[model samples]
Target: MDQMMETKKHNTNKGQKLNVQPLRTQTDIETAKFFLSKNKMGKRDLLLFLFGINTGLRASDIVVRKVGEFRNTKKPYIVEEKTHKRRKLNLSNLAEQIDEYIADKSDDDWLFPSYKDRSKHLTVNGVYRMFEVLGKQMGRDDLGTHTMRKTFGYHYYKRTHDIATLMEIFNHSSQQITKRYIGITEDEIDNSLDHFSIGI
Candidate 1:
């Protein structure tokens, strides 16, 4: 019955267009963290949320990670599920927190374990539902699991202004797609038109 319901929910969302956007401001990001920390699986969920935004990894990749992969390591690596590309994550910022989280756990333990089954990892659908509820709490109808990846791209581009590096990071085909993916193209268009004048 539970599996059936999960399948139904997945099917309902499978073909729908994703209109989600990144948490475009620091306040929005912080608020998301705050709300995630107060959730039922507060610490685990918050850590998952942090890992997502911090590493720009997809939920599928993030949820399947094991504690040994990250513990005592400043550079945890993975082969991206979608692209099948090997990427080494620079986790210097998260090293301490990750170590603390996994301190008592076995090396084989899932980083984000299922709430119902400790031996199993959290599913992607589970993460989707978590972000869905988080979106509602934050008054953002356009939030989803993808928001973390997009948020990472958005802020990285903002700080570095190096689209080429980000493009390689995301493995995107072109700069336009990368720009649009992170919601900066729209912001640029709006900013250009906001002060446009034809001398008329």
Candidate 2:
């Protein structure tokens, strides 16, 4: 799965998916705070999880978000780095955490700033490596930064059956490709059948 996402070559590009798989589970979200806190990092599980799972922005776009950009008194949407388009998405957990992180912060700046350098942006590869080590420590090796996108499309389509919405977010060409992106398969259908009885 790590091999699928080719290196992000262009610093200026947005939504250029390397097609790598996501390495997330509900546990990753649940225990993420405790882990980061132990490392003396401020906990933003909600932000990380929402960024990972909700918006289909690549990690490059995800990490650069400023707290002011999302939960400010001034805006409903922010400009995306890769696409440079005005992007808007719901803010259930995202808004809440952005509020918490920025409430006491001096600058109210970059949402996911680098550990060593607060003013500098955090790299996508950095977030990827952090989560990679976290996943390994937890004995869960099947996850990655892209896991959020995978889960977002998976659950969104699961609840709404709205492939078009996902297609637009992921910028895919078709619904079929979107389904594949979410990794839905016949096995999910086969397993679900045990709970339902089709009228014959």
Candidate 3:
């Protein structure tokens, strides 16, 4: 356990790992939702969380997609730019919300385009900063942009309990990397022991 904590500390200090606080509890989710719902951020912040969490996608891939990429209301699917794989994601929950939000917005415009150039989409760093601000506003210092993506990975793994599925979703080549990506720390291992009360 001590060794794992040291490794985690080293990883965090080196920026090699994101020391994210898992949004495991309902209260944590509420906190994230509360800050995101602030009038100052409006729809963009909510959109970022929805996009990141629902898609389990890297911010880089999402920042560049044009409205046309997802404008086809008939077939709502996002073609992943990095993997060249089209993602048929479920949007029923927020589809109406986003449509209402962007009723007057143009399809040629970016989904999260840059202010300087509507032709260009929002940069990863831009989205990162936006999330950082929201996290700070919520007094969650451990929050980072990567937190949402990792949160998605963690929950997806929990729901599916299929590491192969997660590996495919994240495009990871190995379970080892997926394990780390999904927040499999030594503490989690110890916690699992609590569930091992075999009724002999």
Candidate 4:
């Protein structure tokens, strides 16, 4: 039996809106993880979500990967399907999860294979639908596939506070673009205002 076919069933909401936004906060990310973890048939989807936020890979590149790509490696690399850029990621912590997720599967098996058809990997739209299902479950109607990438960028900037480095990572033309892309402008403004004083 296929890995996804052995798990319990899940029902999805209907007529969901397609407009989506980033996962945004750590709390929101955790909450989404919690919900996904509860679904018995969602192991693959859960891993896909984690890999997305951690590696910041676009859904296109992420959905096409095989389970064996992450074995026994501290630095797993991927070529961005959209920009054709090569990225090497430090994901040693993810090795255990990858190992567990792919235990019974062969090296050639898709990490996130389609539930209905194991012969083909899940499509980008399939990933979008996965996020959409989880988004509605978490009352985050704005959450979309890009949320994973934005979450990575947002938290990366928060931790490093290095826009130039982030700009390079994201391949943006300028710090201004990086700031806006990661929603840092408002954060900077709010942080500065919080430190403002008028001789109190």
Candidate number of the best TM-score: 1
Off by over 4 Å in 1: 1-11, 14-17, 196-200
lDDT of each: 0.84, 0.63, 0.67, 0.73
**Candidate 3 vs candidate 4, lDDT winner:** 4
Worst 10 residues of 4 by lDDT: 1-10
Error of 4 at 136 (Å): 1.6
Off by over 4 Å in 2: 1-37, 42-46, 73-75, 106-108, 186-200
TM of each candidate vs. truth: 0.89, 0.73, 0.75, 0.80
lDDT of 4 by residue, 134-195 (tens): 87798767666667776788888888888788787777778887676666776779889997
The total number of steric clashes, by the backbone 3 Å criterion, in model 3 comes to 0
lDDT of 3 at 81: 68
lDDT of 1: 0.84
- Candidate 1, 1-200: lDDT as tens digits: 21223345565875222566888899998999999999888999999988989998878889999999987789977999878999999999988889999999989999999999989999987888888888789877777667888899999999999999998988888888889888898899999998788976
Ranking by TM-score: 1, 4, 3, 2
State the lDDT of candidate 3 residue by residue for 35-66, as single tens digits: 77774545766776776777677776778766
